[model samples]
Target chain A: MKRIILSGYIFLFISFVISAQGFKVKAGGNQTFYFEDKGGRNQATFFSTTPLEDINGTANGIGGSVTFDVANFAKSLKGTITIQVASMNSGIELRNRHLQSPNWLDAAKYPEISFQIKSVTELKQIADNRLGFKILGDFTLHGVTKEVTADADVTYLDESEQTQKRAPGDLLGVRAKFSINLSEYGVDNAVIGNKVSEKIEVGVNLVGSNKK
Target chain B: MNRNQKKILTAVVIIIAISFIVWIIFGGEIFTKTQVLVEKKDELFPDMITKEWRNKFIWGLDLTGMVSFLSVIIGGFFYFRLRDKKHK
Candidate 1:
């Protein structure tokens, strides 16, 4: 029995080592949505605290995939994010219904919006313990795909030895900011018949541990 | 099954009816007015209101309205079922 217990401990340790190499993206990350007019003033800001709501509006069972290279932490990030367009919620039931209608997202036809990262610049320390990078990727929305570049900032959260054991790797907080033009993606503003400008601002913050 | 059972069923039916009446009288008006107010607010002072605030109001209405509407429909259905059983 003692020998069996020892082997079990060893097996658990190995599994932990393997898993520790890559950090898992937190679902509760903050994603702020904004829409601006031609004048460049900020118009509307919508927060998607829920990943399910962020992906499409409703909470779908499936989650997005994100992988960061520990060996090349500064160089790149590659992953696939699949969102159910049908789940897009603008708060109002009627507005949600209208958004899903053929005029907007057309959930019945498109159903999903996905993003796949193509490349990223290495992390550079801008301030004390603050790191920043530029991530370039293709964002697919409303059945249209376009290239997008986002600026990301990372901050280290801990320097204590006790905290190190409780949570492995340096505790990292990430914030990414980017913009998209709805017109570029061919999304027509159905709610207001007038053509709403394409520029939409997106900001996301993720907190997790980075290995290596 | 018996007089007691029939009485209980009748009470449930009455409760459901009262709920519907209350919803129509108070909830319905509030729901309608809020909807109109939201539209007007968006149009007249688009700059004054942030998208976050607007979304919050809309989300609250949608969630509350859906719950009330669903409750009424489901409660009515159950109440009618009990009445039918009592008659049989």
Candidate 2:
């Protein structure tokens, strides 16, 4: 028992040396992983000449991103988001396949869709521990990239209760909404008119943690 | 009317009647089901394409097929009707 206790003290000592590096991940380390809840949908039909039959398709796939220090959202920020194009289902298998086809999205040519944030252009305090920000970045899709900005709301969390058991962390939960015109990014397929809305709407919710 | 005109008129009436029947039986379901061209909004196509656009393309194909099919059915009905009358 004495020997085991001695090794535990040594492990704790090792953890302290790495604490300054980033968010605590494991015990004594400043890193944590979050699985997020996101996406909402409204049902609509297509094929009618009337625009009402069109589906909004607002929420499609789920993805994740990494960031450090939840406090940074109160200022400037940077992050990268990744979403698998192949994994998304629009409720039909063949439709999903065709959607990923070369004539369409070409998921094989570009397997992952992503966004890299260059900076946060605006940050405003909405309420206690809540904030709203506009993040500017290059949004890439189907091998095309364009400057896009997303409006996001973040709620910061206190992690002091778990510090004794885990890493000292600043955790933040966020939901962002954005819109883009597909043609602006050169995704203009003349054949698929009216069925797909040219203006695409997207929303993202994720939780990120960093070293306190 | 000449026999040729009569035959053509019969074919037209037959086509319209059959089309109405099919519509009554299957129109609600076939037309109502949202058969959209599923395109990924997340991934941009090189050109402008949309689910509704694809839906219309498919819808057009289906419509063309139905029209052609009705023509053949009604034309055969008329030809057989005339052939049986000639033999009599």
Evaluated with lDDT, which candidate comes out highest? 2
lDDT (10s digit) by residue, model 2, range B1-88: 4476577767776766666565556532233333444543412111212232233212233453577577777776765566534435
Interface RMSD of each: 14.8, 13.7
Candidate 2, residues A52-98, lDDT tens digits: the string is 34333322343545444433442335567766677555544555677
Q: After superposition, how far is residue A114 of candidate 2 from its true place, in Å?
A: 0.7
Candidates' chain B TM-scores in the order shown: 0.35, 0.36
Misplaced by over 4 Å in model 2 are: A1-52, A58-63, A158-171, A193-195, A207-212, B1-87
- State in Å the error of residue A40, model 2: 12
**Candidate 2 global TM-score:** 0.53
Chain B in candidate 1 has what TM-score? Answer: 0.35
Give the fraction of true interface contacts kept by model 1.
0.05
| lDDT for each residue of candidate 1 in A1-212, tens digit (9 for 90 to 100) | 99999999999987754333222333222221111122211222223322222311222212244454443344445665455666444445676688778887788988876656787665464544455678788888788999988886654444257436524544545456677876787778656654333455665433344332
Task: Show the colliding residue pairs in model 1.
Answer: A56-A87, A56-A88, A57-A87, A57-A88, A58-A87, A74-A122, A181-A198, A182-A198
Which 10 consecutive residues of model 2 chain A have the lowest summed lDDT?
Answer: A41-50
